[model samples]
Target: MSTPALTLQGLGKSFGDVRALHDVDVTVESGTVHCVLGENGAGKSTLCNLVFGGYRPDAGRMLLGGNEFHPDSPAAAMAAGVAMVHQHFSLVTTMTVAENLLLTQHGLRMRRRDLTDRLDEIAQRYRLRVDLDQRVATMPVGARQKVEIVKALLREPSLILLDEPTGVLDPAEIDALIDTCRAVAADGTAVVLVTHKLGEVARVADAATVLRRGTVAGGGRMSKTSIAELLTAMVGRTAADLDPTVAATLGLDTAGPRAAARQRHSTALDATAPVLSVEGLCAERADGSTALAQARLAVRPGEIVGIAGVEGNGQSELVAILAGSASATGGTVTLDGTDITAARPATRTELGLGVVPEDRHRDGMVAGMTIAENLFLGQLGRFRRFGLLDRRAIGRAAQAELDRFDVRASGPWVRMGSLSGGNQQKVVLARELSATNLRCLVAAQPTRGLDIGAVDFVLTQLRRAATEGCGVLVVSSEVPELLALCDRVFVAYRGALTGPVETADLTAAQQISELMMGVAA
Candidate 1:
């Protein structure tokens, strides 16, 4: 057989006391895609960084085409025919795509016209179409991802690493990206895909490896291994308890006959009366661009309603209007017959509105404060005693809330910024759900950056809150998440709401995908 494109032999890496990778080994043959599967904190990122020269391995060795390879920096890795596209993009927003591509080519000077021509030729040859003159800031999330892929390919690397590439893409864009990867792999380039989405694995991966707690759990050729075996290796559990319907969609067979019985039962909602009502909502951004236009929706008590769309298309504006952070230009918002259209954020909070914003670090909690302080931020009056503040009471309340949420931290006194992303989200959920007289809960992208376990916990909490008669609205770009949890889903396209389609009636993801593209299903 020809030499493997890349090989890792007993690679190990550590950060202080944490063993990020331990005795891990993987090999990728030429002209094939190798998928790395793991949950959050499962060492997937560390392994990718080790290969891309972001971190030096503490032990073992790496070989590139049977030659011992040690790269001291990303530049060295690039020079050695290896490239990585980070989860968080590294492109300059103000620069044009052509300039961004040229920025990486050191010691090479070419006229702007010549560079554009060369990039156009490469893009045409690879079928990766991109506007060379468009500014990165003006491009949508999907377009920016395509640009990143083009940049990686411009280097003519023998190996490329894509980290969680499909997290922000729509269905059509995801399919296009997968096609691009396949086309590149056909040219004898080794591709390493690090992802959590099982469906993508079944679609494109030639070989799969599962990493659990810094060790190689299991792996094999995709054609030879069963999905049940793969899931068992990644999650460290039998598939017996998983829902068969969801499992089958994810390309895995259910382990037991009772899998159908474990599916979440849909909650019934009253059709006539809505706890929260929004009609003809119109809003604009700071740049005077339309953010929302004529958006209308309703959520009944004890119901979980989902808003599905791509990254943009008025989701953010609607969430802001409901949370009282943004003013609506024209429309009416009512909360249980009370007009909250002109209400302040504090007033909305007083009226039993609990909002978990999309950016947890920016809008959910104050990172500089201690966990205790963040827990009781808006309800400090409850802990106040006599003419002075009650420190002991506040501490006790915060500790209780943290414990109730199962937030794993050093203590309540720990800084909120010091906790993990999942823990910070737990703090947000605990604060909002534990509030007194909570009539409505608005969760926007609640599980965006969380692990599998954290996502399961958050979804359960939302369901439990709905069961207790709180109106729940979940706005997310993830269709599978909405299908799994929401009682009914509303598609948002260009600020218009369409189809409060019952989850029971929705049989396939293509229906939702069509609606997301503003097309009738």
Candidate 2:
């Protein structure tokens, strides 16, 4: 009751036609961790942007420490003791850790030794031990996250807001981050965490606020609520009836129509055939340092294999190699028993290998292109009537997949960039899965940036593909999704695959946490 650290009353905002945030209210007490829970595009981002001065409130009032505060810009917000660590990192990669740490200091002139010393001091105080002299670009994702957290802490803000901070972190790194946040709260600083991870919400939040469709759905103190209860509220149903959550979080709960369609146990996949195989896969930088070393993997027909590890543990390299976008120095790749490692990405796609690339905006789809064009891009061969680009055929095909995949959008003619993040991901899924002759599917971070409902749709499609005898190899940092979806999970550490373990015998979350830190269990 010592006056809330921050308060919002009648909070509202909107884009031109979309009401991003409606008459919302939030309160953060001093020295407590407040968790804002929502699916992607549920107005969580809009709320934080308004608070951080990234956008002006269309209508609202903000009070910081019992005083009115409206920051015109991010710098002004920072100066007013409001700092936000965005979902995406904002550090300058070419700069050293110490340099990034000291970037915001005013007209600071100090020796390198003094800078390192200051960095070490901050690191020790906050329990974050980064390599002070190392460049930000070379650090792992976990370390880079620490750099951002430390940067915010160095300013000594009374309130810190983090937006989906753990989206890129593995299970182990997530635990460490939670510890750090708790330590910060113990120091009397209010922390606001925005995330969709219900487990994290239960673990760290003193109180939880649920948002749905730009409005507060429900909220309660964590001690008085459970993750299941919170999830039910955010989704607007009992946990038992949640089709999307069950399918996405636990791999098509054996009670839905899709699951009931499985009249009997399916036959095990053949262990002999290699729908997709890689041997001695090696990629090197121009400096002769290897990014991948002797990497080997195989995906058989009708199996979902997951690659699990901390971010930057060579997952990106593997994705690039398999996508046919990067050259292998000394490796052979075979698809459907034919060598195709040296082929261009388009050639690989022609050979029945579909890739749902890592970054949806950058690699998966052309943001500037219309949805119709992106959907029929590599499959032009299927629509070549009279040897001309068949607009009518493409439109029919794109519209079909869009409806099948439940992509909510203006139409097939709309630009991919205009869609929401969740819908954008659905677009990727639709294009990748629409190939009738696809022999193997390589999905990297397939459900990244997607909400629970969209995640369920994508996973269901993948499972149905597996049911229909298509091989699947999924790579994700999210353990629960992998645990629930993949038939087998493979541990990767420092560019090495630790082989696969059957999902029946292992929990995805625990195994992933162990693999991330190289622990034996």
Candidate 3:
């Protein structure tokens, strides 16, 4: 048999005192798609980073094509026929797509024509059609992802690694990406897909490995194992015992929690008084072009509503207006009959409206700050006494929240950036849900990049909020996420809002997708 594309004997790495990865072993054969599955912070990224020479292994070794391989840097890894597409991209947004790819070929000093030819060749081969002249900053998340994939393929490496590649894609984009993975493997390149999406793992991978806290937990050939089994391995249990949200995500039965939640709180919500409402909302982009148009919606007390669409279909603009961080050129937004269209974020928070931002790191928390400081960001007045910040009081409250939210951290002193994606999300949820006067909540992509367990926690928290008489409005690209959590779902397309179809309605899903694609009924 031909030599395996990559073989890790006893790979290990550490970050200061934390054992990020232990003695781990995996083998990836050429001409096959191998999936590396794990929960966030379970060392999946660390292993891929080590393999791509983003970090040197603290112990053990790796082999590529039956040759001893220990790359000291990313460049060395590329030179040794290994390429990686990081979960968070490293491209320079100001540059054009062509420029970004050219940066990768700097050492080779290929002529402009040669670069174009190579890009065309790879693009055609993988069906990854991206506008080479388009500025990276202007492209959508899915396009940026395709650019990253193309950049890796341009290297023509024997092995390629992708970290959570589908986290930003819509269903159609995901299908196309999976096809590319198969094509790459068919050409004899080993493709290591590092992700927590067990469904995708089952759909695309030939073999799989599961990691939990830096060690192999369980895995097998894709044909031999099931998504349910891989999920059980990742989170340490069967689907039956998992939260309803988790079960719904895994395509297992949860008996429609949305309907159950409404039924449970029907008496309280019978008045059908909208806790949050928008009427003919119109918004503009920074360049003064229309971003949202004539949008209208309502969320009654104890109700969970959803907005679903492809990315960049005015979802961000709608979210910004709802979050009280952007202006609407016209129309009104009301919270319990109070007009708050021109309200500031702080004012909205104090007026009983909590918002979980789209990009948590950018909008919600300060990564460099301590958890205590981040937790009390908007409500610091609660601890300010006689012109002095009450550190001791903040610490106690932050610790209490940590415990309540089950946020795994080293007390409240740890930097917000140090937590995993899941934990950071938990902290965001804690900050918003802890308010004494939380009447309505607006969350954007609530479970976007979270793992199964984290997803379960976040959804449960939202349900609990609804259970306690708070209205919820969630914006997400995943249809499954919306169907699983919302009592009613809407579609946002070309800045127009359509449908508040009941998720429980027999043909609701078909209608939602049709509306999402701008279909008129």
Candidate 4:
């Protein structure tokens, strides 16, 4: 029998009492895209962390080409012909693409021409185009992702791991990326794709392994298994008929009264006045470059309005302006008849504006602070007594929010960084939603790294918030998310709004996909 390119035998990892992975066995052959499918907490990330040298396994043996492999660090893994493209780009944004590419062990002071030539050669070979001289900061999300992939491929690795690579990409970008991954696999490099997107698995992965509750549930060649079969394996149940997988998890019948309830809610949201409105909004960078110009939008009360666009096309700027973190160069922003164009972030908070920022690691919570401290970050005024923060009161409040939001963590005292990506997002949601007077809620990429269950919970929460008279504006790069949650959807292109169309009107995923790509209806 031929040895697999990569193999994991009885792999197990634990964080104190939390068993992230338990006795997981999987194998990947060369020249194939082997996908790992699991819900958010199913140890898929833990397994990847161990394999990519981000974490040491508690017990297990990893084999590469019939040889024992134990990578002590990411560098060590790279040396052993293993490369990982993180879900988030790891490039230094201030640096040029060529510099970022050469920053690894491949760093060498080559002539500028030589660097560009090398980049061009690699990109052409992999069919992953990128501007070598362009600053990483100026690149689009798709292009930045290409840079990460190019950097990994430049190392000539035997195994490449991509974690949620398409999570932040639009539908068209996703299709392009899928093609790129398929091409990469054709070049004899074993690709390990970690994702929750079943459609992607069906499209690009040659084989898929399903993990559930820290153990391998089932796996087979992608061609042999139907999408429904894979879904069953991943969730431990048959969910073929459900629009989304939350039907069983939420304890609701898909073809029953619950479906009717959701449909009624989705319908009721179609005919309401916007809780938040923006017209002729424009935002500029410090360098005087326009990030958003003439952007107009509306979020109806008791409904979610999703703004879908490729990243760096003014989504960040829009969020910053709305959240009052940055001043809008030109525009009117109103929340229920109150003009807040010049309001500070604190003032916006006081005016019932709840903002869950896109960059969770940077803007959502302070990494150094405890979960409790992070939860109470902008809400200090609410817990203050005679100009002093009530520490005991804040702790109690934090604990309550943690429980209510279903944030899985050790305690309120644990560092925010110690929790998983999903839990961190939950912390952000808890902070923003707890503000009782919130009328306009802005959630940007609310569930970027969360599992299927968490996605459902977050979406459900947003809908519940909307049902209570607070308008919700969701800006996401993922089309399925927008299609699943929002009542009215808008396509953002070069900082321009294109829609206020009802979800029922854009029922087909292809319609939303076309609009996001700047296609006219």
Each model's C-alpha lDDT?
0.82, 0.79, 0.87, 0.80
How many clashing pairs per prediction, in order? 0, 0, 0, 2
Candidate 3 runs further than 4 Å off: 253-268, 287-289
lDDT of 1: 0.82
- Which regions of candidate 1 are displaced past 4 Å? 243-272, 285-290, 365-374, 380-402, 413-421, 506-514
Whole-model lDDT for model 2 versus the true structure?
Answer: 0.79
On lDDT, the stronger of 2 and 3 is: 3
Taking every candidate in turn, the Cα RMSD to the unseen true structure, in Å, is 3.3, 3.6, 1.8, 3.5
lDDT of 2 at 86: 94
Q: Candidate 4, clashing residue pairs?
A: 40-451, 302-466
Name the weakest run of 10 consecutive residues (lDDT summed) in model 2. Answer: 257-266
lDDT per residue for candidate 2 within 1-521, as digits (tens), equals 59989998989998889898998999998889999988877899888889899998988899999999898898888898988999889999999977787776543455567666766776676678778689987777778999898878767799999988987676678899999888888888989999876767767899888889999888878888777777777777665666532444533243342232222113456575879998888777545666777888888888888888777667888888888887888888999988998888888887889888887777888989999988877667778878887888888888888888888876899999888777888888888788777889999988765667667677788888887888899998766566657767787777777667666552445665776777852
Considering only N, C-alpha and C atoms within 3 Å, which residue pairs clash in candidate 2?
Answer: none
Model 1: which ten-residue window has the lowest total lDDT? 254-263
- The lDDT, on a scale of 0 to 1, for candidate 4 is 0.80
TM-score for predicted model 3 compared with the true structure: 0.96
lDDT tens readout by residue for model 4, 1-521? 77799999999998888888989899999999999999877887778778889999888899988899998998888888899999777999999987787776354455567667777777676677777789988777778988888888777789999988977776667788888888888988899999987777878888999999899988889768776777777776666444352443222333442344357445675565667889999888877787887999887777778888777678888998998888887889998888999988888888889999988898888999999998887667788899898888988888899999999877798899888788888888888888878888999988776667677678778878987888899988766556556666787777777776556553445666776677862
Best by lDDT: 3
